[model samples]
Target: MTPDATLAARVTVDLDALAANWRALDELSGGTASAVVKADAYGLGAARVAPALARAGARRFFVALPDEGAALRAVLGPGPEICILGGFAPADIAVFRDHALVPVLNSAAQARAWFAAMPGAPAGLQVDSGMNRLGMEADELAGLLPLPPSVGFVMSHLACADEPEHPLNARQLGDFRALTDGLGLPRSLAATGGILLGRAFRFDFTRPGVGIYGGAPFAESRPVVTLEVPVIQLRDVAPGEAVGYGATWTADRPARIATIAAGYADGILRAAGAGGLAAFHAGRRLPGAGRVSMDLITLDVTGCAEIGPGTMVEILGPSQGVDQLAAAAGTIGYEILTSLGSRYSRRYTGG
Candidate 1:
């Protein structure tokens, strides 16, 4: 059955897990935690997620661009600091100031333009440690930056913190410390992974995006998002019965298959069917059958006794990590979370 045209299907979000995850990350970071709620809270309904975090006592938040920061301001209300990870565009200057959002200054040009556009606005400076993505050049900061009180904190991105023990962890941490110490700016260097790298990298505030929402960049945190889809149709197929659009799987024996109303268009990649499994009925394992189509994906249910339509099957959480799904899809938890389709009916558990 398709989700109602008027009512969205419920996408269960566990706010308790989210709160627990946040507190865990906070403790890991020596009780300093900020949150990154970009890309619609990684496609898990940011409107619901952001307020939940605020209620959990999160005083700081981050977003990728100005629009997201503005939208978050609307939901999260005033009093919390919102940092835009992406550097500012001239167009966002007025909006950023009016909304009380802090821009993460990346390049010398952004710094010059932002100051020119909105002089004396509160801003954060991001130094390029090793990501080489967004942030100021090391050499450029010494000459261009005035060390003004308008700058809130000096920040850097860690490239290899995800591996925990990677040598780059120490290198980035040491570089970030050596650069920002005694600059009189509040400092932050850890993402989810940095928290796991011991307390040395945990500076004044730690911004965690994925761990708060149950995507494990660090295994220490529990899941916060659970995808459970209802089994729509069930049918018996004879041996050699090719299933789904591409006829990718041929039944070796009489097989029962069930189709779920989720597909590539909803962010479950076409490749998830490549030897991936789904869970149902108190955790019965079933193989992903054939190809994942635009609005539907099939699962082999031959061994599932007493299974039929209207039963819910879990796509992730407890049974499988999103990391495994990302591996199957040739992507990452960040991409999978951000790319989740908007069609699901959603529900949030706990306050």
Candidate 2:
């Protein structure tokens, strides 16, 4: 068998689609579009994804930590801007300065620390607006009026931009405007969802994260990932035979069972088994037969022709995207994508 065909599972990342998604979002932004490579580009291997994005004309990237930014700098080799969304501490200043990372100061304290340690350095200001998760509150921002010349831009996150019609979207927008309307600084208030909210939220630049990775809130984005696992064994189960832990599934009649070489350990959420998840073979849907184990899952593959050990089964692919898989796992697509295990043989195509 070919090297890839022999693998128990594989994750194929279409860098071409990823770059296209960024271009699409960038076009929609009406301004500059920055890539969010945080969490390893939402666990799709930022080392590869960031370069593909940069090649597609992306000039800025965002990460959640200083280390992530520093690593990306090494891979990108300078020129592009790497901003840290998680802010920074005194200890992190060295990493930021050495790597030329811009910190999105989220609080008065963080702002003070950045200015005190690295005066005249480029930094971004993050106002909370209404998320109450990060960034300086309106009152807090008011106290720091007349921001330093070193502050490169002002930004805020949308709490309900994905919902579009969510009242909080307008509320947050109004709050963001109230805090930054006359700042005369380059401002950003949108990510993927916020970009979809229309030109009103695009501001000066937009950061596109999950949407660039083929997740929701960017419904038109091209799918970027496909996952498949090999069926390692096949067996016939008699009626009344129970399968897997807790005897959760029982055969009602003669059934052909295929044991695939993947499970929760492979980032297939255990909850998916109970969520009526299924595997696909040659366009045929095969319902899962039992609970997902640490390294294997049994699927009812009866009536399928030409099936046996070494046959590959589709888990997340053309028939089932990440959002659909996330629904089956009772989680969000971000969790599904970021949770993917390292065991899969990852293949990249069309950068």
What overall lDDT goes with each candidate model? 0.81, 0.92
Model 1 deviation from the true structure expressed as Cα RMSD, one decimal place: 2.4
Against the true structure, candidate 2 reaches a TM-score of 0.97
Q: Highest TM-score: which candidate?
A: 2
User: Any runs in candidate 1 off by more than 4 Å, and if so which?
Assistant: 1-9
- Candidate 2 local lDDT, 1-351, one digit each (tens): 334456459899999999999999999997499999999999899999999999999998999999999999999998999999999799987899999999999999999899999999999999988999999987888888878999999999999888988999999989999989888999999999999999999999999999999999799989999888998888899999988888999999999999998999989999999998898888889899989999999999998867777889899887888998899889989999999999999999999
lDDT of 2 at 163: 92
Clashing pairs in 2: none
Per-prediction count of colliding residue pairs? 9, 0
Clashing pairs in 1: 8-345, 9-345, 9-346, 10-345, 10-346, 11-345, 11-346, 11-347, 266-341
TM-score of each: 0.94, 0.97
lDDT for model 2:
0.92
